[model samples]
Target: MALQNGFVRKEGIPPKSRSRRPAPDRRYERLLARQGLAPTAGVDEVGRGSLAGPLVAAAVILPLRIRLHPWLDDSKRLDSRRRLSVCDWLVGLPGVAYGIGFASVEEIDRWNVLGATMLAMSRAVLALAEKPGVVLVDGREAPPLEMPVRAIVGGDRRCASIAAASVLAKVTRDRWMTEVGRDHPRFGFARHKGYGTDDHWEALRRYGPTPLHRRSFLGRLSEEAIPHLPWDDGAIEPRGGP
Candidate 1:
């Protein structure tokens, strides 16, 4: 397979002979073009399924004429070092802008993961200093935004702007977990970034649940087996004294 124009083409196809395949996300491009928008923001979220840590959302606005990076793709498809490097480059770009937002564990418990994820995305879009004319979001549902919105299923894989957002969110959240790991070293947050990996599960069993763990999620587990480990209820109590 040979790469061309943000897609992989078969080896035998000559560039001149092959009919140009429509751009994977041309609908979004056409929408922006129709509106005469120079910077179209793409938004995505990470850590929605984590048993610990906050849900992180990122919104990225890329210049309309961005040249595709060879390594750019969905964040899940890239390894850690490459994702971090790309994220740094993306943040420093002249015409690009990005921001991150997070929903805390308590918010996740109250609103549930999907709702909290959307809330985080909305906050990220709002955090941008320069307002975007139109926002493109990864996945099938669009989070309500102050500006126009379009949600594309698999946008991260198909759209460069959305892919860049995914990288930013993933890298930012991973770095956050690593920093938190230093304080709570036993959880190994730096290693798994709060995902429900076997190591993370073992750590949970050993240390009970940390403040970062989603209490509502733990409540749904089999009580007979795991015992629903106790948390410091006083720490999470309402601010006013009882």
Candidate 2:
């Protein structure tokens, strides 16, 4: 974007229209139905790499008959406002059951981010109104649960249920961060949503980490935190050893 007469000007090829974006298919649901799995749950987590705020997970079950909208894609593909609107719409739909869960910052520090993510995912599944026949997790590692689990690397982009879960989880965490930002306005948690941006690090330097900051991620509050797992644009690859 370029500033033109105090207004932001857009250049280069225009971004693709949302209607053109591919919608998550119902392949997973159809396959599950063939195997007698009526209600398949899709699970996804958000804020796993955040320097602050709790890790949130959501489980969503979209009925097989419901038609997924083209705009209903991966949470990462949509902006914050769009994600929030999608989540709200999904929850209100008939035959759509979803659950939201969280793991506190202290839990993240104690169990490490990956372990805490699993814990949160488990909680999300358990929170559902009724247990699903099978769970489709949006990653390589599936959380331990009583029901059958399938780990799909890009489930959110390919599975409608997973995409809905991602949007719900993302908006839930973003809203939580925004509410917490009121208590601690210096860190700008509402803006970055607890990501380790340069401005966030500067705030940590100036005011030091609040109780919400994950101690495991601090690296003694140095310029750069150790154990960098290469997180970019919310596409975090969880390490086995945490």
Candidate 3:
């Protein structure tokens, strides 16, 4: 069997060999093993830095018995097609369960990005049909949750479970942004997926900001005109109304 792009089994582990001992999965495998936990859920988030669109989180309970795709590194390391393929395989696994949650642009603006990200991650874990014994979160900071949680810095790259969660979260958010692009054609969200790419900035420059644009993020583009209710004599009038 071909290993996934970013991973190779440790030197002593033969290719296609299944051993009772836990394979050297990644940097965090020893940490998870030391916890005396057999089954743990990994959590990760995507789109935290986008100029538009919601922050998406995913929690995944991976099957400890089976061999995972070797290319299972951080989602950012994989291309879109590979990530989507891995996501579909993960979602279809019998022992695996996954849940997705989103914190909208409005929520991000209201609570600030970090808080909103934590909110989305918490929601994803809570939404799982069956909670795992331990939750492995991919980041330096632990989310505020009632469950016993372990936060791993660079966990998405260091932990297999967290990497799976990252792939799922990334694919889910990208698909959502593509759909949102259909409704708001001017933003070309399908191409840039709400990232502040040159294409996105050009679109913002040409067509102005959309409802999905993060107004707080527009300070750099301060000269650009953003869509908002024009105040008349210090009173804002509702659009298409008297």
Candidate 4:
């Protein structure tokens, strides 16, 4: 079989790739489990850097020891089909508990992306029927959760629960933006998933921002040509720049 780009690219995710990161594992989970955090949940957020749409987060608690996708790592590392497949498996998988939460564009403008991300993560954790013993957050900053929080840099790639959460949050947000794309076909939200893509920028330049756009994000990322752009939403300290 002819290998494409040093690996066989297939309809679903293949075992190998041109470049590969270490797949997510249960190392952190075991470490924490030994420390008495039996039910540890992983929390991850997506769409933080988007120019439009809501910021979403997901919390997932998996069984102490179980085998999942051999290729599971970060949601960003997977194709759409594999991510959705893993998401479905995680959701339906026995002994897995998860929750999803969102912060609207208004909230992002109001609290700043960092603050809004913390808010979304907190909401995701709280959305669960029963809180876990501890939370393993994907980033260095921990969310304001009632339970213990252990923030790990690149937890999504190093932690199984966090990887699951990442996939769930990403799929949820992507589907949401795709639906919005139906109503506003010009912005190509479906294609870019609300990222600051070139097509998205051109659309914004021609049609202006929709209700879904973050005014603060636009003012920071775009040129001054757009008239009446909200430079500062007055919700938070104006953060980020060109």
Clashes of each: 0, 0, 3, 0
What are the models' TM-scores?
0.81, 0.82, 0.80, 0.84
Say what the RMSD of model 4 is.
8.1
Candidate 4, clashing residue pairs? Answer: none
For model 4, what is the alpha-carbon lDDT of residue 224? 55
Clashing pairs in 1: none
CA displacement after TM-score superposition, residue 7 of candidate 3 (Å): 21
RMSD of each: 6.6, 10.8, 8.6, 8.1
User: Lowest-lDDT window of 10 residues in candidate 4?
Assistant: 233-242
Q: lDDT tens digits, residues 69-134, model 2?
A: 556879999987788678778878898888888888878988999999999999889989978999
> What local distance difference test score does each model get?
0.78, 0.82, 0.76, 0.82
Better of 3 and 4 by lDDT: 4
| Error at 221, model 1, angstroms | 4.2
lDDT, model 2, position 67? 70
RMSD (CA, Å), candidate 3 to true, equals: 8.6
lDDT of 2 at 226: 32
lDDT of 4 by residue, 1-242 (tens): 45666866665666554455668888888888899887889999999999988899999999976788765669999999999889888888787888888888888988999999999899889887667999999988998777889999989988999999999999888888887678788888889999988888888887777777888888644555554454343332111100
